[model samples]
Target: MINKYNNSNKDVKYLYKNFLNIGQVGLLDKFDFSEDKIVQAKKCTLYTESGREILDLTSGFGTQNLGYNNDKIISERIAFANNNELPFSRLFFNEDVAKLAKKISSMLPGSLQYSFFSNSGAEANEGALKLAFKYHNGQRKLLIHNKDSFHGKLIATSQITNSPEVYFDFQSSLETDCIDLSNTDLLEEKVLKNKDNIYAIIIEPFSASLARPIDFKTLLKIQEICNREDIVLIFDEVYSGFFRTSNLFYFMNESDLLPDIVTYSKSFGGGISSVSGYTTKEKVFTKAYGSQKDALLHSSTYSNYVEESRVALKALSIFSNTNFQEEINQKRKYFIKKIHEITNLKYVESLTGDGFHWGIGFEKIKLLNLDKLLKLLPLEITKDPRFAEKLYVSSIINELYRKYNILSYAGFNSEIKLFISPPIIISEQEIDHAVESIIKTVEKKPLVLMTSFVQNYLLRFLNKN
Candidate 1:
């Protein structure tokens, strides 16, 4: 079968109807926004087909931390590609992999000495789960996850994901028990009840659900409980890893506790489509590597892809350089200060998140209307959901894309949660542009409604009694 790239609006619609049917086209089709609206991106800015400049606020869902078309990264990748490096090779030693492992080990605190690479976050989590089981000799069987937390999309990780939508299709396949992140009492009770059976307690240190910091005290308590129960504490830091959270690692600066296993992806690849790593204590590897057979027990085809490792090494090098963290902190402080100033809108419940990853809660928006709008637009186009809490978020990503060209990901099925995670490399001028765009978008809804009849229809659909 020949693969065709859909460029025109008619082509996209035709392909959507003919080729893609079951796949959810949340934001792409709903808004009726044309591909022409997207300005091909270069560096940090995106240009529309009409030559409108858009300051990217979402950072391609927080993957492009180094920004779009980073010259250094691009050049490095080009050099690697030109050299004809084999990304996948069985039974071979790659120098790039060793270099990346060395670089990662150098940055990590304590004895997180080993690195295992994978293609995506889910694959990394799968490796961690298998390693945890193998380390404990399979005596532990239960995999505990926090409620409403996202880990990955693979079977094992999906089983542990708290989102019902993620598990909606394969509910029967999921076999893990979930506990509410906020409920300390239940957590203790569950751990006690299944102490021997529980192999790992995996958590997203900074939860995307509320875009809030995990309670430090509760986290420490959970750590203690895990120690007492002999359960492996796994921190899934795919979304909050790197220096994106202002801290080098989410668990390092924010909480005193440490996990036995930590999985990282997304930004770790340096905006590339490959690379993921799991850090574990030496003992875990020692136990797993007791024999040669055990060493080959868990491995991926692309476990140590050279190009990805090289990118990861370079990304880490960039992260470790001085001034990166300071710049991130400065930007975060400025953003928070500006966000606090915009309190005129009554729909915003609270703003939460760390470093570059933040969420706006809409406590006062109408959920039904928000759902209708979301149904009509692409998932990235709108942030509001049906929940009263979601409505109060009082922000429209579509307007941001329209006036300022800043694209953000809006939450689904919830009342209100808008994720804003830009690259750490964003300049102050870009930051100012993003903030101004947000301000303009929030204040200029009337104008937006005037331009798009869809917006007017959505408003009327929302206002109907």
Candidate 2:
């Protein structure tokens, strides 16, 4: 096999060059991997080309629930590859796929037994939306999503997602509206107003970007509303599934609060296989694509291949172990407490989150607030309120990687918030190390922190070079 990385700056340049040629350069800029490129990883620690050991907190956006380079997953992949079974057609009956589906069904709540496999979380959500739309006989055209919620980037899914500016080009022309999660009154108002034309209400169950988990009572209320109006409800567990939130799923453990359709991926494949799936009740499946004539209506070419299926089956087994779940809960409490303790720092505004996920927001120092100082001079900086805070968090993240080898990121589109979502397997020692790193990284001198202003200039120079 050809090598993807050569442990050199040339390789990094080639990766960035092609990445900027087609993809969003802003994403690359948000992450400062300029010092070295990662060549291997084990659990929560990343091994870089320059022999630096970096602790991963993002878990590749929460996909590595079991952490990286899992031995069992790797052995399974090798076994599957050695068996010469791959890229097989899903048209034929595959025992491994059926078994995996059955395993997943046993763990899901209520009558969510029927399954549809796909390649990614986006594809699973796309299939879920289609299922909901077809279940209602294409009669309901409107969908509701909570503000700052992320579902996927597919055309229909993107329409229901909260960030219109990011995925607007992929949006559907259909009617869709967003409701604020902070106000249940407004949420209910929107649901009632659009009750007649609504096909579904898709949500992340827990807002990944905001690091907020919806209370069980609120979820029950939403479920009741959807049921009363005959609207399909979808829980997008792409980032929260497979014990990331100290639960197999945030919506699990409650029989009455189950959604009509549940979409999952990310950690479900144990960071080994790119697999995703959607599950619903038999009634909904029958209404949508259960007919013999609609057998192949929503299937994908890579849907239920044997390799991904076997890997998912193993992943489910590992995640469902009771002992593992208990340990994860303990880790969650420790992690959250440590993060909250950091709020005592002068610059930290607040720590908002639950379980193993969190967002650390910073306060602008009055003395060093460049914008405020400029206003004193009868001049002004950018009007964005979070500009200074964003720069501060970005600088902290950069320093965290450079000084302590702990990976972190600014919250999605939010300047002051730093996202912390380490793998479930992360230990107490690692958590303590992360907390110390964050404190030391953020508690820098004002003049030293101001150097983050060079990011724009550095980006422009890199793009030109």
Candidate 3:
């Protein structure tokens, strides 16, 4: 086989050059072309140039629950595609879509039986919001979202998202009435006072911004309030779904509370291109878009993309299997124990998360050098809010690439939290390596040695060049 990173390959060189020119490197811009480029992936690992192996901890932003290039899912998709299946069958029903919908609905708890397929997480959230408004006849106008929750990037989802920077350019179109996620009392008051005017109240079961897990009791209470006031409760489980949080669904495992509408996406496709449908009670669907004319109210051209749906169907099967859940729980317990043991690190103020998703909050860490790293990153990567924290993580990633070649992203912004959601197929040894890398990075005072050692290295590199 030809070399993976052969500079002679004009296609690869052209792509890399274009990436450097137009990429909007954001968040701590640390990743660059000079680094190893991954050309193939398998299980929980990526294969880069020079045969370097990088363990994936972020799981492509938590979409690869089962891990990269799952063999079974790939086989299923290939089988579907080999049959010359049409991807877009407008207004026509396909068996794979029906079967996938049935499988997803079967896995969910309660009367969440209806499924509306979409191509992305944002589309799923948008569908959910539209469903909520249609169900309540648009009389209920306000939708409540948590302060640090990330829904999606569509116009509606962007509005509900609490990040000022993400929605900075789209201020005019963003929603104006989202409440602070922590203040439950205010949420209750708003729901009670605006029952007639409120369409739905959406929340991330696990708060991504604070890296805090919502209390089960609080979630239950929110459900109770929504129920009492006839407001629709929507759980944006795009990030916390499909065993990422130690359960089949975060809402199902975290609490007994049920929401009127629940949206899922990430990890559903098993790292494939597919998105997912939102589940809701039969009544909600009937009340919202009961007629044929209303069917088009929330449909996507890629709603039933054949290959993506096939992968999703297989992925759902993998997650629903009992053995996978048992294995994941065992691994989760061990991982949490190891994190707790690293209590002496000064930067680690607290560690919080459940299932496969978790975060580490840093107290104080100067981030100038981290900023320099960010300036070097490519632009396709989303800008994280926790810049300092991300910079620290990028440093660790860079070191790992230099030595062990492990690659992972710093989730959120500069808040000192490293978002981790390794693939379900990750080995114990891989987890140990990740933990060791993180602990070593946190304990070592790289910033302190910057003036003497780090600066000298930079100066030497500049002189040599």
- Score every model by TM-score: 0.86, 0.89, 0.88
**lDDT tens digits, residue span 241-324, model 1:** 886675777888754677888889888877875788798878777786568778788787778887778877888887887786
**Which residue runs does candidate 2 get wrong by more than 4 Å?**
1-4, 18-32, 164-171, 253-255, 364-385, 414-416, 445-447, 452-465
Please write out the lDDT profile of model 2 over residues 244-292, one tens digit for every residue. Answer: 7757887885667889999999988889889999989888999888889
Q: Which numbered prediction scores highest in lDDT against the true structure? A: 2
Q: Cα deviation in Å at residue 250, candidate 1? A: 1.0
Judge candidate 1 at residue 219 and give its lDDT: 82
Residue 15 in model 1: lDDT: 70
Q: After superposition, which runs of candidate 1 have C-alpha atoms over 4 Å from their true positions?
A: 1-6, 20-23, 32-34, 37-39, 167-174, 366-395, 413-415, 443-465
Rank order by lDDT, top first? 2, 3, 1
> By descending TM-score, how would the candidates be arranged?
2, 3, 1
Stretches of model 3 off by over 4 angstroms after superposition? 1-29, 32-34, 164-176, 366-390, 448-465
Candidate 3 lDDT score at position 193:
75
lDDT-wise, the better of 2 and 3 is 2
